[model samples]
Target: MWKSHPKALPYLFLSEMWERFGYYLMIGIFTLYLKDVEAGFAMTEKEASDLYGTFIALVFLTPFIGGLIADRYFGYKKSIVIGGLMMGAGYMLMGIHDKTMLYLAMTLVILGNGFFKPNISTLLGNFYNDDQYKDKKDEGYNIFYMGINVGAFICNFFGAALQILLGWQYAFMAAGIGMFIGVVVFLMGTKHYGDKTEKKGVQEGDMPFYKIVLFILLPSVIFGVIGWLIKGIQSDTNLDSYIFGSDSTDAFIFACIPVIFFYGSLYFKAKSEDKRPIGALLAIFAVVILFWAVFKLNGSALNTWADRYTDREITGTTQTVFNSLKLAKEIEYKKDSTELYDAGFRLQKENGAVKKVVDYPIYFRNVKEDKKPEEGSKISIWATNLSQSINPGWVIILTPLVVAFFTFLRSRKKEPSTPTKIAFGLLISALSVLVMVAAVQIGNNGTEKVSVWWLVANYGVITIGELFLSPMGLSVVSKLSPKNITSLMMGGWFLSTSIGNKMSGVLASLWDTYDNKANFFWVNFALLMFATLLMFALLKQLNKVMKEKGIN
Candidate 1:
């Protein structure tokens, strides 16, 4: 892989690998940590999922500003370094365990990711811009994407071990260490970047930074404030009063209005020659929002499934190996000591206040009577966070095969356009939701635990969809964007992701309302199918734009 690619590819790959190691490690456990009764924030399922969604949405949102700043002033390398340090600090500070400190830490990670994520991707695209590597850009991005999954795949084991052996704080600290290591590795390869790191600076007809601040940023802030303050409808979950499902969701959606407008203006304001490609990019961005909306549920709803609905018990050799690695923990069966719940949760009065608490031993509630352990016996169960690795593990396994499949198609000049791949990706991802639907049926809608293989099968299918769409999205942005604002366009891609992520949260927050869990998966399936149809409808125009650009 290194021999065929630029010298800088290895450095970028390794730097990205470690960066994702930190990010994924933190994300894999974020909601679990929030919902943990003893060691975590003690938030309900709805609260944890909502906050997780908002946090990730903001993490992606800041890239819009970070990418613009890098394009005009700070340059890629400086922005990445600053962002990495901030993220590392944020991860470390999360170990302090105070709610205020957690919010402050989350803010740092959000802002830091904005600076680090888009710029690094833009820098890698820069290396492939030269004619010598131009034809290899898609392959280059696939290889780079594999590196990201490599990090995502391996981090969960580390997280599981740290959380089991030490605690949540130690696992968080490990994420900080991983980020710092990424920064050191990145600096080691600075000379390899050379002029690729240079800022593009302002170009003719470009909106000046101060004007953007005044027109876009200021309005976004004002809109967000209004969104937060204005009450919309009365609902069981909206006692605090919010337009959307939550205050954060309402604020985030409103804040995005100006940024969305700015991207729209780019198409209208573009040089006549640049108009079509910009429009095509924006259309693709809009369609893929649904893809992310469904795909990103791995962190919230799916995590909940793995934790409560999956059969995670291990015995014999498997249990022994996992125990030796500290990847599994023992839970004693003590019915008398556990609180009995009428449903999924119980309302308890504490200090004259009624609070709803998740039943921690809810895992055993659905087990077959014959399989239940004796009162004093213990069962070895794998860590729930390890389930987070399934998607990335599939990515690591399937990437080379997918690349080879595309390479074979390219050899015969039969490869589909990037837009087409994305369309199929949505279709395939929609199918993955059906697997969960089936699992719901087999598990009797959470009355019985289902086999873990169901989760594996679901991830295997979706990972293929992810491979088709995600890296290709990056490749398309790099290919279609006007040279001056490449990073800014990359930000647009993340902006779509931000919206989708928030949408995922909103959907996940409704999990409790669905008495039949299959309905939740069906809703997800409908969303992806709708996106797939829309993408297919626009294929001809998108392909025409690709042909106009003289590349695919």
Candidate 2:
């Protein structure tokens, strides 16, 4: 894989692979750990989803400051090392099983990711800036993206096996080990990236560090607090009364106002030669939020689908192999005591009287009584987190093919521009949501178990769109950014992703509100479709800017 790439590619690849291994491993079981009534934190679905979304949003959000700090002071290597160690500690700390410890651990991971995530990619972008490797930039990012998914693809098996065989704590410990390994691998490759890793100090007209803190960062914090503490005039539910569904949502939105202004201010302040490319990037950044908003449902709404609606039971050879590998666990069919609580399916009164509702480990609340397994019988079902791997799994399988397809277009001198590809990517992704819409109709809207193939198919289709859009976004950022603020622009790309990810949480939190799940998918489709149209509307102007900048 590194044969035609830069000398630095292998090291960056392995480091990122291990880093993603840890991050995805933790993410795979995070909500499950939180909602496990027996031994875990027993949070309700809304609460868990809220925290999960907020955690991930902040995880990406901090990259802005991290990128700035790296650009101005620490450089990529030092920042990355610090970030990796912090994340390793955070993952290990998750095993403590206290709420305060959990919050503290989550804070570390969030801060660590802020430092780690954007810099590595920015470092890679620095390598591709050379004329020798410039044309291969898209291919480079695609391969790098594959490295990320490789870790994402493989980590779930470890997460699943460890959680099933030992405990969540052991699984978390494994995640920490992965982070440590990533930091080690990164150190070994220092010589290759030494030139690229230097701190990029501020250039002429750039905002001073203190001004950015005072004007952007400090104000964002104050705005977030205002959003959080202000009482509503007349509503009962706090979320409904707020501006954007919940306090976190409102706070995040308010906090972003200054950041958004800062980015816009960049275009106006840029040297005339740099303005159009920056403007084009800002346009693309805004449009791609819809993509991430829908795509990031993998861990929440989609996980719920796999848990409740999909048929996970296996028998004979499949069951034997899965059980032996710790890919599946036995959930005994019995009236699980009230102790086996899942708040999403907790008891609700009916007929003016209260009755005991046995919420079992298996999500069988909507399953017909006759269709359920016999009491005391054991059934082996695949781990829910295994479903989390489907996107990365598809990425692993299809990346080479997608790369080859684009390479073919390049060979013919007819390749689409990066921006054009993103427009079409949005279109294809919108179509993928239709697959879920069909799944809803087939499963009778979660009333009965549906074939697991539905989940597989949905992921497979979205994977194609993901291939077209995601790394291409990275490639464009590398291609268009001014030399002095490359990492800052990279951070801008992820900042857009951060906002989108938070929206995903908001959307998933509302999953129970929809009577027909298909409508939920329709909403996703509409969002993506609108984004697609906007991209096309701006395509000509974007292309002109790319030509002016001598980039694709």
Candidate 3:
């Protein structure tokens, strides 16, 4: 793959792979670790999911500012190094196990991601700007994306092993170590980043940075404070009257209003020639929000599913292999007793008062009589967070095939434009949710432990949609954006991702509200379907712009 691409491709790819390995490894177990009563914060599902949503949202959102700063001030290489170190420190600090330290650590990771994520991606696209490699931009990004998932695919095993053997702290430390290694790799290959780090001086129509800080960031902070202070003012329940879904949810949504308006103003005030392309970007960005909203559930609602509902029981060859490999987590069963209940998900009292009751594992209600453990017997099962690997595993397996398929399409003049690919992606992702709908029915709405195969099947289908949409979003932004604002537009893509990520949290926090369970998946399906319809509606206009820009 690097044969025709820049020589830097392999090193950048490997650096990113290691970075994502650390990041995903930490994220794979984030919620599970947060909810662990003995070795964790023992937060409720709503609390943990809400926080998870906000964390990832901010993690993506800051790239807007980070990209701008790198474009004008710090070079990409310097920004990336700084971001990596900050993230490494954050991951290591999270192992301290204090709530205050946790929040501080999350802040560091969020800011670090802002600086690191967009700049690295921008640098890759810069490499492809040359005439010789221009046509292969999409393929390059696909390859880079595969690197990310390659790391994502393997990290969970390391996370699972360390968490099981040493503890959550050690697992987190491994994440920090992985991040540091990525930084070292980037430094070793600094020579290759030369032309890609050009500073884009302020363009004619750009807003001043001070104005942005005063009018945008300051208002966001004030709005966030208000959102937090008034959480329970309207409803007796602490959650019901909140602005979005939770206090953090409300704050994040409110804080984004000014920034969202800023992106809109760019199009509204653009010169006539720049208008069509910016409009196309904004429209596509809107639709893809649904995609990220669903995909990000891997860290929230889906993690809950893996932890509570999936049948993790391994037997015969499978059991023996996992056990010998030291990848399984052993949980002792005391029937007619409730250790698992307390260690599992729970609901809050309507008044936000602490409820002593431990929520039942949605899985236990339906275990086959034969499979249910003897009242006093202990059961050793695979860890729930280990299920997080499925999608990345699919990515690692399917990337080459998908790339080949697109290559074939390109050769035949049959490949869709990026916008069209995203439309189809949204529609396909809707179908993936339907798989979960089926799983819910088959599992009797978590009355019994569903086969791990159900989770595997769901991820497999979604991975196809992801291949169609996710990397294409990056390629689209790089292709259509004004040269000076390329990184800024890339930030816009991540902003949409930020919004969708927060929405995923909002959706995940409501897991208990949908007693039927299938209704939850159905809601996700409808959201994506709506996004698909919107995309198809604008396809002609978007395609016209793509043709005008000579990007397709």
* Maximum-lDDT candidate: 1
Q: Compose the digit string of candidate 2's lDDT tens values, residues 1-552.
A: 577789989889999999999999998888778877766887766767777888888998899899889988999999999999999999999978999999999999999998999889889989998999998877788778878999999999999999999989999999999999999999999888867999978877566889879988898899889888764555665545777777888788888888899899989988998998899999999999999999988888898888888989889999999999999999766654443344543443568664545434656665667878887888898988999889999999998898888889999999999999999999999999999999999888888888899999999999999988987898799789997676668878989999999988888888888899999999999999999999999999998988887877
Expressed as tens digits, the lDDT of each residue in 1-552 for candidate 1 is 688788889888999999999999999999998887777877888899899899988898898889888888999999999999999999988867799999999999999998999889889989999999998887888788888999999999999999999999999999999999999999999889999999988887566889879877899999998888877878776677678888888888898898899889989989999999999999999999999998999999999999989999999999999999999999876564335554445556678776766644667878877889998799999999999999999998999899899989999999999999999999999999999999999999998999999999999999999989997898799789998676578778988999999999989989998999999999999999999999999999999999999988
Model 3: ten consecutive residues of lowest lDDT: 333-342
Off by over 4 Å in 1: 130-136, 235-237, 270-273, 337-339, 342-360, 483-485
Clashes of each: 0, 0, 1
The local distance difference test score of each candidate is 0.90, 0.87, 0.84
Q: lDDT score, residue 218, model 3?
A: 90
Candidate 3 regions off by >4 Å? Answer: 1-4, 131-136, 194-206, 230-233, 236-240, 337-366
Per-model TM against the reference? 0.93, 0.92, 0.92
Q: Which residue pairs of candidate 1 clash?
A: none
lDDT of 3 at 322: 78
Candidate 1: residue 85 Cα off by (Å): 0.8
Q: Pick the candidate with the highest TM-score.
A: 1
Pairs of residues at least 3 apart in sequence or in different chains that clash in candidate 2: none
